[model samples]
Target: MEWLERMNRAIDYIEENLTGDIELSEAARMACCSSYHFQRMFSFITNVTLSEYIRRRRLTLAALELQHSGVAKVIDVALKYGYDSPVSFARAFHALHGITPAMARQDGIALKAYPRLSFLITIRGADAMNYRIETKESFEVFGIEGIFRTDGDGEAPQTPAKLWEQSHANGDVKQLEARAGVLPSFVSQDLYPVNAVCSYRKTGPDTFPYMLCAFKEENSNTDGYTTVTIPAYTWVIFPSEPHQWEQFGDTIETLYRRFYTEWLPTAGYEQVDGVEFEMNGTKNGLNYIELWFAVRKI
Candidate 1:
């Protein structure tokens, strides 16, 4: 996260201009990256989407100004943040703070304040990651999936525990695993929509029936599991330390953020269409784990 210093600098720039026009292109320059790349990196590193963060921060400031300052006109506040009118700002403010601007101004409503972000590089290079880039035909995956939403940073859905419990109680997951060790995948869906985290198993591409996949096509041989054909692509494989299960989501998020925000820009790789995969070697205590991703040269 050494490069996070640049992110912090960018945050400072945002804070300084919350009252003025804040452009995505300008912010990208502050971060020393292109707008698309900066926005993507910002979402990954912060674990909160950039647009969401800005909206929250803006509303928080507006609420504070209403409470503590002399800005009596809602339209004025809205215009200051680039909103077209009071109605628009109020709508956005309600979405973020769960209350309309007028109500919040009069009733002292609670608001979410997104503090400026800071990134610090930590040195822990001991953990070994096992992964390799792969090139295969485009594929499809089929399996029953459940969507889980994160409450905020580090607040993932509890569905995994439930899914595992129900699957084991019904002996469905065990049966499925017995068929083959299918790897679970974490996918970013709906382009940063609230509660957009989904977990799934590979099926097949453009096939009538989809199948749940366990491990890579090479690892297992089983009857129930289906093979999905995937297009050839480069991949990055990372290994997790022995016995670190509780922090799986946090660790994965951190690594992915660093890989995208810090590593990939200089590493000369761009994401390609392929399902991201997570391999857990030891489920009982998390002795080790691996993450697989698809990529190609920029």
Candidate 2:
């Protein structure tokens, strides 16, 4: 199946199972992508977390059921939508629609509706997207790593910035740069920050490791840092225009949005399970970066 078709089918699956327990793994499976990639891509494309989307959807349906079915009790509606208790259901409902179930059922209450989502590819003017596909052998990256979670507003939290500050203050970045055997020219290059998942477990809060790293050999000295092995995989590289240090964050976020919504659907490749990295550097007095996404041909 095509990438678009698979994505739409995933949406269909979510709609069908909204009232039941939905697993991120199953949703990604329906979309033919890994859970990590699916969640990231879904958030980038829709600007909402997967859980938030599911919650809004369930609440929307629950509100309708409560308003229309005069005989249906609030507890029945809540349980039907997978809420364990009426209290929990009312809390979530009020949070989303700004009104409780009883208020919604009253004469003149307005309830917000989040209709089901369907995706379609629309063509605008053809603006060239600069990227290259390349396969590399396995490699290792050594650096300071920390865990960060996504905020409620769908923004990556400030934990990563705190990690970088700690690393810089303690001279860990310099230590890793001096130990670099490969990419020496860019070793001390403070531009690129590599982010990857050591392991993805499907329970609890969503979090992942973000690393400030450089290329290292297998026999690199064990010091005050950690190392992660990146297996061989094909990568799609998106290089950005030169920008100032302050603009780096916004630039990368824009690139991600473009990658998911504009590039991947037409790039003739599907994402694979592997590490993603950013290559940062400076040229002609302007800082630049490149995003690398692991993928395989569809």
Candidate 3:
């Protein structure tokens, strides 16, 4: 199936299972990608997490049922939508619609609704994407790792920055740099940070491991640091532009948003099962960064 069709089918699957158990695995299956890639793509394209999208959809439907169904019990409606108890349902419902279930039954109560989503291919060549496709062999990286939750908003989360600060304060970054045998040459600085997803299947809803890392030799002793192996795959690298330091985060976010939303459906490529990473560097006195995603031809 085509990428757009696969994504639309995923949305259809979610709609069909809204009143039942909706598994990320099932959605990913329909989308023809791994759960991690599907979730990441969905968030980047829709600007909301999968869990958040599901919750809003469920609450939206629940509000409609409450407002229109004259004799339906609140507990029945809640249980139908996978809420274990009325209290939990009420909390979620109020959070989304800003009105209680009982209040929704009263006349003229306005409720917000999250409509079903569909995918389309939009031709967006206004801003040329500075990216290239390359294949690389398996490599190892040694780094200091920390757990971080990616926020729903496009902004970079503060947790990774905090981890970097902690590592610097404790001298772990310097120690790692000193022990490094094969340093990352992309950056002029001695320390090169690579943020990567840990394990796709094991990652929590919002949490993944972020690593401040450098390339290491085969025999290098990684006594205190965590070592991760990046498997060989074809990667699409998005190189940063010069003089965009002030809009760095926003630019990266826009690139991602465009890549997933506008590019993927027509790119004739699909993301493979692997961790994605961001490379932070500097070149010729300008800040440089690149996003790397493992992919395969569709």
Candidate 4:
């Protein structure tokens, strides 16, 4: 319930500022999280990016105003909703409503509307989530890193998967795997296999750096990848049940969805400012993946 309140408060902030400049940071503050985490949580829970949600809501209101107000000018309505020019505004407006801003003034015209958002929970079947918490010493990892923007008018966050594919295609993954021990058979539990993502204090307004890498073993070779050090922190680890290799993606995604929706709100913990791991490997001829979220007791 508290989590719902924080999120709904954030929605209220967005709703109140629909006609003016809405600072995502302020909305995150109302939700008691960093801007990046808030956006991530929002996307996961709502299946919509925060920026796109805001855009839809703004356009919904602008459409209503344009349809009702006989005196409303297209340029003035466009500026009210943060578009600097009528052309850009019309482009966005038509994309959402399938009609132009000028057409919006025609009586009996149709427009799409996205109502304000509020967070709530619904009781489903007796599903279970598996997780553990561990506090470990600070560690260092080496890998290839790329900065990605969280907010845009694009598709869902596929950057992580894309990064993995790129590494595999370009021999980056092979290079690291060649020097590193194979999982389960030779790698220590401390060695996050080839799956760890890290440290933050949001690097940019809409961008965060994601790494495709592994824990730096003392004698392991680091010939090509850059190394990054992550400070000590507590992590909540969620492990999906061991399954066949073909089910890896679905299993991991379900685990992540449960982590944010079923765990974070009720578990009395919050994702902290540090590293996270997508700890994965094979054991007993079955593949498995775990999500390690750096967290603190709320």
Query: Largest lDDT belongs to which candidate?
Result: 4
Task: Please give the lDDT score at residue 152 for candidate 3.
Answer: 37
Q: What C-alpha RMSD separates each model from the true structure?
A: 9.8, 4.0, 4.1, 3.4
- Predict model 1's lDDT versus the native: 0.56
Residue 8 Cα positional deviation in candidate 1, in Å, after optimal superposition: 13
Q: Write the per-residue lDDT of candidate 3 for residues 49-115, one digit (tens) a residue.
A: 8889999999999999989997889999999999999999999999988988889998888989889
Can you give the lDDT of residue 40 in candidate 3?
Answer: 76
Where does candidate 2 clash, by residue pair? Answer: none
**Residue pairs with backbone atoms closer than 3 Å in model 4 (clashes):** none
Q: Write the per-residue lDDT of candidate 2 for residues 1-298, one digit (tens) a residue.
A: 3888988988998999988877767777888766666788899899988888899999999998888877789999999999999999999999999998988787667999998888778786788788888878877777777665534233434566666677778887667666664453423344533333333222223445567776676545647777777778888888888899899899888898899998888878887752577677786798887788888888
TM-score for each candidate, following the candidate numbering: 0.50, 0.83, 0.83, 0.86
Which of 1 and 4 is the better model by TM-score? 4
Residue lDDT tens for model 1, 73-189 = 888888988799888898888888787777766655677676666666545465443445555454444333443332222233234555555655776655655544333233211
Taking all chains together, the TM-score of candidate 1 against the true structure is 0.50
Which residues of candidate 4, in runs, are more than 4 Å off?
A: 152-158, 181-192, 200-202, 244-246
